[model samples]
Target: MGKLACFCILFFNVQLGLCMAPDLSILIVTYNSRRDIEKCLASLRDNSRGARVEIIVCDNASSDGTANFIAQHFPAVNLIRSAHNLGFGRANNLAAQHAHGRFFLLLNPDTWVEEDLAAAIVNFLDTHPEAGGCTPQHLNPDGTIQVGAIRELPTVESLFYQKTGLAYVFPRSRRFGRYCMTWWDHDEVREVEQAGACLALRREVFQQVGGFDESYFMYFEDVELCHAVRAAGYKIFSLSYARVYHIGGQSAKQAVSKNFIEFYRSMCHYFRKHYGAAGVWPVKIIIAVSELLMLLVLTLALPFSKLLPPPQAWSSRWTQWRGHARLLREVWTF
Candidate 1:
């Protein structure tokens, strides 16, 4: 009778231990992302196996009935509807506060993960104690690679070169090379400074770094977070084992001017925060001049460019004008 009681107690303890293990909480922030939210959640729900995981959708007051759709369709999702768009950083931070998982994945609503993506990230983080965060290789909706993951932080010169298309002209110049990862083919895993759209971070490391900085309203927040993580002695890595399909530019394409302003402002915030006011001023001026030149070129070319065929000419001229205007607004406002 004594031996049987001891065995029963040990068995119960083992079961309790297994039950007590925590799961991952995938946190996705949405702002008028109704078009992609359903697909994103579905992919996550169907794919996240082998590890315990929960989905948290933090909606930034999307007027598009995004919250209602999720509530009705994805009953298992933990949804938090905000009163206003609190930008990406703050919304994710709000969701993270309620996340009960051992790890938190900051995913964009426009991205879809592979079935094993979450499990692979969990396994990688489990083995890599020094890694603070990890991101998967991102593919476009058409299966093309996206050029976002970069090893170097954006300096004023790098930004200028990239913005003005000088990098494409002289890809080998040290200044131009810094902007575009001149050597990277986007096929392999490598150390990256930031991967904003799809990234997973250990809860402890995330909390220790105080999460994403709210000062950055939209852009450069991920890069800033990476800097903070590295400062805290944690490594940021890109994992090739996992993949995500990113439907890029849904939000930014909405209003070109506002989006451009916010993006450039975020860039300025990043530069000033890291490189100081004095160092960033020169770069700011250069960016401003380059933007002015671009605007002049676009304004002069738009009329002539519009003389082509109806479909092709209209699209070509409109896109060129929009691109130039966006660049000018970003450089000057931010």
Candidate 2:
């Protein structure tokens, strides 16, 4: 049948008695997330407003016995325990493959939802046909707007600002803060390039993108996926209504060094993938030189000690810097 005829037929059919099945699956990839998963799951359960959301938890062989904890406490949760740590991308993909729902929610185990988050997202997608994915507004434990919740695509200037901490100096500047969309008030519905933490998309988009790039391993997978979805002619929306209290760095706290390395490694890979050979070289150089400067700064600050977190352990800060340096080396060689 023709396009108009098909549309009319479906419209009439839906008007008569067409009822679709429940099609929302919340996919959370967990790694040593026991500290936060309970609250996360509880919030989902409490705030779902009786909507049927298939919650799938993918455990990445956490040493902290997170899988057993979930199994013991939340018997209703469908948990997939991997024998070894498959990282975030592959673990999520593993669950996505097993998911029967049409809408996939790539959520973090550290996030606690507000009332009816699933319903709001599903409703948005149902109403706005162009939106390929929607990310909720991020709130910290204290209810402040969370940084790193959403971000713009990488550019030499934005990347440089983000790395050297110039973005903090001009947190409200459109150009300087473009990397994280920090200038926005978090009160409007708008299209965004990337949703760093929580993202919801239909199964068709997931199939078309073939899920996240496994090369990312952890970070920037969302940004890469958002890029692919937009390239496929779909809009990515940031909805202010669906709020999530994000306990950032829940998984990264386990091994700060490893996650630090993966962060830069993924950043380099993302740049290389998005920006071709011509565009990748400058970013590589910027990353190298800027990292060297940061290494020196952090080394000098290591002794002063009172500036950052973990008040007593300056050693931990130094250790993280060492890991970052290793990542810079890997990126430079690549």
Candidate 3:
């Protein structure tokens, strides 16, 4: 089918509400993601089984022709094109409005789903009424377990530990690594406060919590959604059986500086929204001091980096130094 034909079908679905809704709607948002979207869609085509699934791709005004590629190759997909780059949360919300599925799966363009992943998610949600959402085990492309897939809500102490390098230095300490749940081996089915990257949630649950908080442009939207769902008395779960391979940083790496700044900016927004300014004052102080200290150290080491390894090269260290300086300035006002 052509682009016109796809739009016509989508229009009829919206106006008439005539088609039967599917069991799952896998929603993907793309911005210059043609490189990964093809393989991601192919995996879903080859592996998804035992469920009625509909795939929707919301293109965020990609200059790389990502929208055209999907329209030409994956003609069955319901594609929504935006005029500008609506950030991650807004793009997914736009896709969800066009979706007709009982469950919504927020899938990253960089991931490939396993054969039974969709079916398993449907069955799990059907059986566990108390669970509002669930996330699969995220594995690196090399097949190693991806840590930081599940975590608790960030608090002052957790943010301090993360920024000051205490979390990395004491990965297994329950006190220092509580936010990322670093002590857990990621080998069991259990309740969690937040799950990142990809997740599946009931339509009602998503609607009830008002979907991803559109205030976030890049990071912590998932955390905010999970927080709202838990506050509404639904459990967020991590399932060890289902797995997805993630090629991390596929999108963010394209604009490293913007992403770095956005990460810290979103963190401050999250803290303000949930913890209030006064509640998270200590976190702001921690971030400012840590980033400032790193910037100063990197400045002093720039001259010596030429004598060190490539990782410590002047160019690399200078880039990191600039990122930290910008990050420190970003959080200073917060």
TM-score winner:
3
Which residue runs of candidate 3 sit more than 4 Å off their true CA positions?
Answer: 1-20, 307-315
lDDT of 1 at 323: 62
TM-score of each: 0.86, 0.88, 0.91
User: lDDT for every model?
Assistant: 0.80, 0.83, 0.87
Clashing pairs in 1: 264-334, 265-334
Encode model 3's per-residue lDDT on 1-334: one tens digit a residue: 6999999998988866544558899999999999999989988987777788999999999999999999999999999999999999999999999988999999999999756688889999999998899999889989998877778988888888898899999999999989888988988999988876789999999999899899898888888888898999999899989898898777777877788788777888888888787866777788889888888888888999878675422248778788888778777675
Candidate 2 lDDT, tens digit per residue, 208-323? Answer: 98898888788878888888898899888989878988878767766767776777777778888877767778888887887788788778778876665652322477675776
Tell me the lDDT of candidate 1. Answer: 0.80
Regarding TM-score, does 1 or 3 come out ahead? 3
RMSD (CA, Å), candidate 1 to true, equals: 4.3
Stretches > 4 Å off in candidate 1: 1-22, 149-151, 170-175, 308-334
Query: Which pairs of residues collide in candidate 3?
Result: none
Query: Model 1, 1-334: lDDT tens per residue?
Result: 9999999999999998668655688999888889999889998888888888888999999998999999999999999999999988999899999898888888889998766788888898898887888888888888777765444677776777776788878765666766556656666767777777888899999999999899887877888888898888888788866789998777886665567667767777888888897777766787778778877876777687647554322246667567656666556545
lDDT, model 3, position 233: 92
In terms of TM-score, which candidate is stronger, 1 or 2? 2
TM-score of predicted structure 2: 0.88
Question: Candidate 2 overall Cα lDDT vs. reference?
Answer: 0.83
